[model samples]
Target: MFDTMTMTKVVGGLCGTFLVFLLGGWAGDIIYAGGGGHGDHAQAYVIEVASADDAGEVVEEVDFSEIMATASAADGEGLWRNCRSCHSLEPGVNSTGPSLYGIVGRTVGSEDGFNYSGALVAVADVWDADHLNGFLENPKGYAPGTAMGYNGMRKIEDRANLIAYLDSLDD
Candidate 1:
């Protein structure tokens, strides 16, 4: 039968467990307290980085063609994994985007059955390395109204490598 003593013991056990947790948290807070207001605590250690202005290093503009010439198709093949979801490497096969098999020199927005947005055609006539570079660098930026929602590959090396790989597929 449910008795007053049995209920009191059960309640006491719960209160004891709660007290243990409360005391433990209070102790931990005291032990780990930083003792400073917002943004006032000293950094554990400072990492010194050189400022571009202070370094006075001249950054020469890199030629895109030169970068493209050195691109490795093999490296680009690895990067293609990212594009695999939307585009097909096989000619005549279209996915969310058009096939990229002959993209290197193919006319923009000319993929047979794929409904390309007018954005790509408006930006460039052909998918040459240069145009591909700009497009790969920023898809939405290059073609403002294109359906290619990919944010873009940011690095020039990556864009060059991907183009080289696509070019190699058709050759």
Candidate 2:
């Protein structure tokens, strides 16, 4: 049978212990902590990274034309599966997206029936390889407010292959 007074003493002891531990933690942190903010301490030595601008070296930017020169339409046919859900390869037939039938060489925003974002024609006159490359790399970035909701293909090879596959469709 524990009394109320005994219970109070036990509770007080536990709370006091907890407070001591808490204060110890606070003091220890104050005494042993590292500099609080980022870049507060001097770096010993920066490992020099070879950037394009550094070391009298210039990086030659590889154009997509060079990449597309080696693109494979056969492999690109596989990439077409991802587009089939929203686009059609048949000419004059529109899906959620307009028919990609002659898209590669076709005029921008000129796919007949399907209404485009009106931002595309401002970017380019035709859907040439270079234009298509930039568009496929970033739809919204290239056209600003295109209706296409695609996040865009990041790889140059994929864009080139897909462009090649679309080019092969009209031929």
Candidate 3:
């Protein structure tokens, strides 16, 4: 025979479990919907490239000097703040990433005495303005297995500014 107390306890436990699941789902929704951060800010949407043609591959492109002229150093400094956590501008002061002393116009993965990822070393060429822009825009895509864990900058303006800032650091 089921007693009244036993029935009440069983019902209460079931209700509690259901309530927990509901609350957890609600919290998860809130977190994801908040744009991965807790602030009101604009985000640059990514342009997906499904196919080689859809990827906007240009076989022959005309020179666009206006884009280069519009780069802003101040804006680049603003963007560099995000990188400061892993990199240092000071000479011989390496952090999570290598110290970025005179990084602009220098050979990629060629920082003396720094341990670089093989992926980065693979792209050991000059980091010209155009190359830096592309790399900053998408690190993983630029170098398949680079140790730099940053997702590329989505906004063109941000990449330009960041490149300008880096350029100014030349020795």
State the C-alpha lDDT per candidate.
0.88, 0.88, 0.80
lDDT (tens digit, per residue) of candidate 2 on 1-171: 799999999999999999999999987776668523343678779897886666786557888889999999998999988889999988899989999998888888888899887889899999999999998888999999788898899888998999998898886
Report the lDDT tens digits of candidate 1 across residue range 1-171: 779999999999999999999998887776677423334667799988988778877778899999999999999999999999988888899999888888888988898999977877789888899988888888888889888888999888999998899999986
The best candidate by TM-score is 2
RMSD of each: 6.2, 5.3, 14.2
At residue 92, candidate 3 shows an lDDT of 73
Model 2: weakest 10-residue lDDT segment is: 31-40
By the TM-score metric, which is better: model 1 or model 2? Answer: 2
Q: Using alpha carbons, what is the TM-score of model 1?
A: 0.66
Instruction: Please list all clashing residue pairs in model 3, or write none if there are none.
Output: none
Each prediction's TM-score versus the true structure: 0.66, 0.70, 0.60
Candidate 2 clashes between residue pairs 3 or more apart in a chain or in different chains:
none
Sort every candidate by TM-score, greatest first.
2, 1, 3
Error of 1 at 113 (Å): 0.5
Candidate 3 global CA lDDT score:
0.80
